[model samples]
Target: MASEGAEYDRTRGAGDTAEATGEGGRETAAPPDPKIAAAVAAAEAAGPQHGETVRIDSWIWSVRLVKTRSLGATACRGGHVRVNGERVKPAHSVRVGDEVRLRHEGRERVVVVKRLIRKRVGAPVAAQCYID
Candidate 1:
């Protein structure tokens, strides 16, 4: 019985360490993709320090509200997207605090722009750019 308990303790300790280091006992924070990094850098350079305005379609894509910029633009042109209760074109400017309503995939998603990001990013990063 003592041997079994010792084995259990070792297994639990190993599991904890594995989780800390990520799967396969390796750290997970790999370097950012070069393309993504470049895009983000360009976006940051073109806009103000923060709270800058961006095109509606670009904002939607950047926030991961749509899968792609073309899809976002299509929704805007199809009248499936509105800003502050008024229909807007894809080229319309979206600023911080603006309310956006997008109808897609048989559902409506309403979001408020909290921060503007012009480049596409991972889902976790994109989620930080808006308020639902």
Candidate 2:
């Protein structure tokens, strides 16, 4: 008799041990791919750690707020970007908790720095680096 919430393994016949099949007759999770593991390890190694300072333009691009680093720099130079209520240059330093405002394509994006990352990451990872 199987419990109401328990999974039943009907395939298990007499003398068939659970170890021969898997955990409770379910297959085990496969090991991570070597290439993916290496890429993740490399990203973690190169990613910004605590108490790191990153350039405003660089940070913007790294967080995926801008499509490219050059666009970020251009926006800064054109006075289309502001950090903490002050217009700053591309080389300006941006720290955690600073509010960044960028006006692009007639729209404004406001974000608060939560983590500082230097290298460009995937959109999901980039989203973790800021609070919008």
- Please, what are the lDDT tens digits per residue for candidate 1 over residues 7-114? 999999999997876743322342245555455556556554654568999989988989999999999999999999999999999988899999999999999987
Candidate 1 minimal-lDDT segment of 10 residues: 23-32
**TM-score between model 2 and native:** 0.66
Best by lDDT: 1
**Candidate 1: where is the Cα deviation over 4 Å?**
1-52
Q: For each of the candidates, give the backbone clash count.
A: 0, 0
Local distance difference test values of all predictions, in order:
0.82, 0.80
TM-scores for candidates 1 onward, in order: 0.64, 0.66
Error of 1 at 102 (Å): 0.3
